[model samples]
Target: MGKTTGFMEYDRKTAEERDPRTRIGDWNEYQLPMAEAELRKQGARCMDCGTPFCHTGILIDGKDSGCPLYNLIPEWNDLVYRGRWKEALERLLHTNNFPEFTGRVCPAPCEGACTVAINDPAVAIKSIEREIIDRGFAEGWIVPEPPQTRTGKRVAIIGSGPAGLAAADQLNRAGHTVSVYERDDRIGGLLMYGIPNMKLEKSLVDRRVNLLREEGIAFVTNTEIGNDITMEQLQNDYDAVIVCTGAQKHRELPIEGRKLDGIHLAMPYLTQSTKALLDANYEANINATGKDVIVIGGGDTGADCVATALRQRCNSVVQFGRHPRQPDERSEDNPWPEYPFVFTLDYAYEEATAQFGRDPRQYSIITKRIVGDENGHVKELHTVEAEKIPAENGGYTFRDIPGSEKVWPTQLVLLAIGFEGAEDSILVGSDLEHKRRKVKAEYGQYTTNLEGVFAAGDVRRGQSLIVWAIHEGREAARECDRYLMGTTRLP
Candidate 1:
């Protein structure tokens, strides 16, 4: 620990955000930086307990408790508290290949598992991490470090998301020639498109990609395997193949009027919006301008859609969730150390409440049908109030209440329910086995049924956080390294 009673002396403080009204005008990040001194004080709040659970990468009740990337949280916290930012940056990069991404977007489960959180507020780990990395970038400390020698073994990675990029970084560090293939025009699969720019700017993604390029990792964009290039060619040419193609197969709400013209999936809508922003041309974009939008689903994607619609100057927005409202505090059944199931206002909900007089979320409501006009454009949405009932399989099912049907005007609807699994177009001719829509690979090994074939990230584990994807990719690279040589030094 940097200070003996630092945890008691200093209270946890985090980064502030720009006014919602001002931030909504542009697609830039809203987080305002904290002074270096306040950030150091926040870092000093880390108790650094003897048995720190912040770094333990374990799952309790099937929810992440600690840092999934196994980041040296306490070590870095102490380094930051002592003003040893360069050492802190090194420690942050030891496990996480891209702290910039996680520091911005990760939900920060480490705070949930913090020892100080048992009594008072947890340390501002995410904010401290962001400061360390941002400072590193500003001071020109973050530069590409290519491997000293090449192993003469070429490896191919499909889908250039967090997992693919992480695996490529590790493999390159292990002296392997790594080449990443991305179907999209840009390298980041989900980071570049699925996520909105206000939360994480595209420039940050490009910065990391440029650093990877300097590290001797080849990024092949607009080229897909099994289509532009054959799977057989990959197997023959590359010493190993890692499939990090994220779960792009979005889940659909195939209900009444499902094929309506004004309805769309969340990813394509989000992707198109980002593309338009990048091109500096707003015409012919999938925007919610001058429309009353209804976003279906209650997860992060739905929240993102809500924010995106607000930014596009939508007249009104309502987000629907099928389940009941979560409690403000954790119940006995949902104790601490597991992901807190309590209700907290995300950025979108806060923005909506600020702009409009009320929160835009409507819980315990199910979409019955999408009402369309004579011209086939979506005009309104019909919904019914629902309640959860105990099911025979120890689960709950929604039961619609009679005489509770209502209709609301909406010109556009975005389905942000969730992803199903990996897309089939790329995996059709591959040798990898699959379960449901996900690629069949074990947790630690990350190997497919075929020899020398590996899978990771959402493709293997289903939809998850970016930190988990990085962890999976790193482990997969270690396994791949071991497979290539009798012994390996990768960690």
Candidate 2:
């Protein structure tokens, strides 16, 4: 609501990008920054609609509108429009603990649901938000704000991804001693590994981790619970324990030739490549050099695989998905503010299309088998045509088309079918009970069956967006605080 006539005056302007060729040469962020003047214009585009769904952050029609954390979007946009960059950053950080991460990685569900998008293009909210934070960093306004004093109570978090980190941030702000534990050699779970450095630079995560450390939020890497330390010890050592380990068990494709060497889980492949790039690895890295790679799955992770393979000098890269090609525009089924399924090119796909003759995506493809070479390594993928059959139930089923099988030339096949739940490595003797072995936490409660234990994020809710994880973390922290203390003030 910066200006009544603002939405009419400005068109949506997002940040530009570095040339694909130049950006692909390195494993860092490629999104170019917008000049302050242009950014101000973009800020002015905030119509501040009467409904203002941008801050609602609710899932309407199965899509997210506004910031899930209820970021003060219009207020900050007004601040940015008036050239008060520091104030804008303050407003951005008021609710969002890590705008730096979300500003870049989030799918911007808010913009998709923006009221202006009904007739005109939505405001460049994400870009302007990023601008606010980057300007804060440039002005040295972003600093570590550790707790002034510590309460007698102590807490332990079992993961360092956004969920755990968010919980620690809240609990520590509540004056409790907080220590995070991660099984990986590094602190971040998926943030440090599952995502590629090119998309979300590892250094960015490291920057925040370093600040968390400086703020006295103890982080213990390589100290996995239920292994390095016992769950009983954790329950007794700390007043409360929170499990924020992300859902990492990738759904398997138990098709023919499933054990082929070249076919690997998408996350592990992405993890290995990131660890190699970050020197966080002391093991053999997965490389796609001089290989024709077929990454099965059309999600962001699969796209990252394509980008990483290109950096490793892959001969060719092709991606496959069972879903049919979506319409270029949002369909009636995909209405406002809910996450709409539409055909849009991500950066990785854009780079691949620019370098290769065509876009690397093959829609309506269902891999039936992994074709292998003489040495037992996968050399190609056997796929069949697939169709979406609307089921009697709400969910649709994938129907295979007869005689549509074909072999796709490939040396590496990465499955990015998404995660199932938290790895079973840390569940033993944790006092947490599982309903059918799934984390048994009530929706919105986030409390596990075990006493004094809570779960959130992908661990509790399964694989989801960073925004949802952060939301759950915040809610879980509040619940934990209430359980620990007689009353709570956390929002």
Candidate 3:
């Protein structure tokens, strides 16, 4: 509340982006940062609402609404408006551990739940968030706030993704020596390898990791729980164990020609593409250069695949989805204050439309089979229109329409149907039992069948957002701390 009338005085503004035609030529960040003055104006737009619903991280209609990390949105916005950036960074760091990562990649739920969004555009929360953290890094304000005293308790957090990192951060702040074990060659787990670099620069991830290392946190890389060091040994070594290994298993297309050479799971394809871009693809690289590519599933992962493929210079690219295209306007059933189920173009779609002369999305379509060449390579894809019938339960049922089959030239087929759960190989090897393939832990507690072992993040709750992962990790940290010490104070 720098100015009493600031919300009315300023229009919401955000980061700009280069057009697809120009940005697709290089594998760099397309989201252009907003000028400082504009960012300040956007920050000033935060009204001094007495009950700021933006930070009220509560459940809405059974869905996790608002900021899961409960960021001090209005406080920081006002601080930025008053030119007190350092103070704003402190407020921002009050809850969130990594604002830099969420600032870039997260589809901000806070803005969606903003109180100002009743009629006007929502405040540019994400942009201001990114600016605050970047300012912290540039001004050297970000430091490792290691715990003051040791509790003589040890904890092992498997998987260094958002969840594992948050759990470790909280436990470390509680004066417990935390050791993060990552199966990957590097830390940050999905943030390090799964996500494309352009959307979120790896430098930001590395910067936080470096700071964590400076704080005396021991990071053991390439050491899996069941494989490298058996879970039995982990329990014997540590007082408590937290399973934060995210869901790595991908859903598959159980159709003909599924064993074709050019077909790949979304995670592997995305992971390989990121590796090629950073590590430089070698002899047998999975390059989409000058190839016809079709990405299945029209979610963010699919869009990321399209963007990555375009950057790799794919000749033609398209994405297909099974459900009917969403409507442009929200229906009466979906009134205000609810997450709108309206069709809107995302960044990837915008880029593809600009580069490829049309939107890459084809809705209400289902892939029947993968048409492959004689030598066991995917050549083309066969698809059919999915007809919909209104469901008595207030939804719709899909049926394969007749005489609507078609094929698209596809040298590469990336399946992005989303992940199911974490790989059970390690869990089973650890002799941990599970419910629905997830670690069978009682609600409100992350305890597993094996004593002194717990699970969190996608591994515990299935595939979820980074914010939820962070929350679960923090909660699990408290439980683990309480288990080690009869009483705990860390939150």
Candidate 4:
């Protein structure tokens, strides 16, 4: 409990956002800082409940019900309310390895499960977490604390994403000589290249990487394990190996004109943009400048593509979702305390509406084909309207509406339809068991079929949130430590 009557005395107030029109001109993070006093008031809004569900991570109806990291939401909220930011940061770090990353990008399932959210707005947990970490860095309270002694044991972590980074951090803290290998030129894996700078600035990732380096954790970039090096070499060089290679296999659309010049996958486009930004080169081969862009897919990646195209000064933009639009409010089946599948305006949606004077999303639409010009470049996209067909079994299917075809002239098409699983190249000769495209490992054990080899994050659990990746990474590191030292003192 933050305050006896704090919930009744204060209302939730989150950080302000930069104007969408102006923010679309730059790649920097668009969120403005929240005043310390105002943030304290928001923290005071946390209710005194017997059992706060916000910190209980559970899966209900195949959806997240609370924070996956099992963050100490009430403790931190009370700390923030009492102006104990240093203590709040310490509490946040107890469960989450990187509050900066999750505070910026995580969808905040904790808020949905808040007891107060049943009737009123949830506590601003994510904003408070972000503020605590940012203040810690600004005040120089966050410093690299290397282990006291070396254990003479070495561990190798593949894929430098959140999961790999979390594992590396834990293993290094346990006095083990840890080395992380990344195929990308820079560390931070997807954090470095996958996400756009607007949502999460690159400088933040670089800052953490520098701290990790100063703490004696070795980072090897531009060297992949299975390709540049071999699995046998990894096994021979290290005491144990943990594969955190995330699911990078992008789903593709096998429709007409799929091989056109102007059509590209979302990851490559986003990666190229970030790389070009870092290298001070704006002329990317897959740029969307002066083109009419059509982004297919309705997930976060698709929204990111739309925002990128807008920043690139595309002439026009449109997004398509295969399923119909959801209700503005929660439906009967989606009750409180469960992640609500409702329609909400995201940053890209707001920007598109502001710039174009209308929402760019067209629900219940399916792309039939991609039309190309004589130059063999994407020129237009053909789509058909979808109609919902109800069945007696309380299920439904989508049927294409007849005579509802439409086409739009466009030059760039980005497929942001999500990912399947880990790439096959890395797992080609590995004697690891798998389910579907993901490596098979028990939830808590994190052990693969092969001895001394483990898998975690999206590679084992499929596509998931950054918090889950961090949790898996930490758990996998503990298992690896136990395997090497016969026991682990790590949390």
Q: Can you give the lDDT of residue 196 in candidate 2?
A: 80
TM-score of each: 0.98, 0.97, 0.95, 0.98
Error of 4 at 160 (Å): 0.6
Put down candidate 3 lDDT per residue, 1-491, tens digits, no spaces: 65678779988878888877898887787788778788889888887777777777666665556787889898899888888999999999888889999899887778877767867778899999999999898898877767678878888889999999998988888888889999877899989888888888888788898888777678999888888898989899999999989888888889998899988877777777776666754332476889998999988899999988888889988999988889877677665555556798887888888887899999999898888888989999999999888999987888999999998988988899988787866667788887666777764688888889988888888887888888788888888888888878866
Deviation of model 4 at 203, angstroms: 0.5
Deviating ranges (above 4 Å) for candidate 3: 281-284, 390-395
Give lDDT: candidate 2, residue 320: 95
> Of the pair 1 and 4, which is ahead by lDDT?
4
Report model 2's TM-score to 2 decimal places.
0.97
TM-score for candidate 3, please give it.
0.95
Candidate 2 structure quality by residue, lDDT tens digits, 207-300: 8888888888998888878778987788889998888988877799999898988888898888888777777545635789999989889999
- Model 2 whole-model lDDT (C-alpha atoms): 0.84
In model 1, which range of ten residues has the least summed lDDT?
A: 278-287
Displacement of the residue 411 alpha carbon in candidate 4, Å: 0.4
Give the Cα error of residue 46 in candidate 1, in Å: 1.0
